[model samples]
Target: MKPKPPTHITVFAKADGAAPTYWECPSCGFLSGDARFLDTEHPCPECGAVGVERRRFPSDRVRRLDERIRSYQKQGDGEIVVILVMTLLETILEDILDRMMDAHGGDLPLRRMIMDSQRSIGVRIGKLFPALAGEEFEEAAAELGYRDFPKHWRTMREARNAFIHDSPFGGPRERLDARMGEDAMVLLDQAYRLFVLLNNRFVADGHTRS
Candidate 1:
């Protein structure tokens, strides 16, 4: 009826290196270099008032973006490891200080401990998402509505610390399911979310692909 949007469309082009040339769109039948629009769906530049799919670049920009996304994916995995380790360590230290501060009843020491932990987390977050560092942690916390995550963080730290210090947490899960199983999962999950967040930021900034 409406031109039945061709069953399929494909593009061919020549490039160096002696390989067959073809650019293709996986969506509705659209040619690679045809009619100026199959990269993303957008308002048609030519037909005026009608919408069309945009064309993708076999251009340097597209290739570069593809490469960058791969690189970020690998880097994201590495950072996830570092974040879990650091957060766990910081949590243990925070727990110890929290107890001390509660016993002492002086805001100075507790404030200092909090500031230190916040700074450490901020520095690590920047390593993962550099753009986030320019903003204050308070603001970020407010944005996330995570004003009281210290307790959770501390628990993670203590769990990790138990594993490190040859404590009961190290026992085989068949013996006790309480500590090791859940804590390890939580840390892993947190690390993964951090990875996703960073990867998304890189894509959004135009430095990488989705």
Candidate 2:
């Protein structure tokens, strides 16, 4: 069957030279990273303004971000599944960290949680291969340039910030749902790709013939 046309969410992009930051909410004065949830009556959380309209436009660096956003609006089962799977993984990881912190009588900050995962995996690898040691892989990733890891992290964080701050995007629940779902999928997919890139590097480093 022919696919349905994608609904274009109104994305407001910053100037071209700047990073794709801050989506303006259409409903209210709220400006945030994600505008998927704002509608007219809801008003802007930031300024209590009403009857605003949201329009989103991403930069070239964030062009791919719109692909899945459009896909979700088109209601593609495959894209939905991909997004759900990645969200599940994130939830599981968070649970594991929570349990570990409970056992240790401490909490893991967001940055620490990400760093610990890499370090834990690296430790296991080091034990099996005496040549590689602590922090070496991280250093290599920093030096040789691992793609998407940090970029996706930033993107996801930005989206979350936009959602929380009640950017002007606040609006009717139905419209917001469509926007939120799209933004969530895009942000998660970006993270998933980064994780995959890191995993691929891990596999390649460990699979040496020597």
Candidate 3:
């Protein structure tokens, strides 16, 4: 099953020791991650509304799932690690897309509708992201110093799919090796940083200013 509109995430904090906190406007559902104005004393940048709630971006549920994945990694179960990390990555992508839509003033229903209509990750990254951010996902990632992230993510997804699905033309992949598992771990770490950058740029940019 695919997700939106929903999603492990469990991102760590920067060297400064503050886990990035996403503050959402209860009034309009606008989200922001600007360190300068994380405190809710400022008005909602989108609607000038007060009382923006502080929400940990990964949320508690995601953190719990992350713990399970880490345990699996510790056990050296490469196949399971690959599958779970792939699922987690997709979930994170969907959420970031939703967050970007929210930043652009899309309400819950509207965001849901958009995500529901466009379920393909390739399409979401190739088309939807540009429509919202005025730049290609690869281009954006390049600017953010993860120039190869999208390509690497796509390659990993293909590996995961080959292992999971049976192909009429070619047999399904039988196993995911330790190398793939390690790659997933690397991507997982990179994902947190990439996600934070995207959130800071798209969800918490000028839209949340008082």
Q: Output the number of the TM-score-best candidate.
A: 3
**What's the lDDT for all of these models?**
0.35, 0.38, 0.72
Tell how far residue 24 is off in model 1, in angstroms: 19
TM-score of each predicted structure versus truth = 0.27, 0.26, 0.77
Using TM-score as the measure, name the better of candidate 1 and candidate 3: 3
TM accuracy, model 1: 0.27
List, residue by residue over 1-210, the lDDT tens digit for candidate 1: 011112222223333222122222322212233433333454322122223343343335434543443343345443333334444434433433333233234367655765466665435433322333234333333333444343455455554445445655455212313343344334433432332222122221221110
Query: What lDDT is reached at residue 196 by model 2?
Result: 28
The order by descending lDDT is: 3, 2, 1
Q: Which candidate would rank higher by TM-score, 2 or 3?
A: 3
For this target, which candidate reaches the highest lDDT against the unseen true structure?
Answer: 3
Alpha carbon lDDT at 186, candidate 2: 53
Which rank order by TM-score, best down to worst? 3, 1, 2
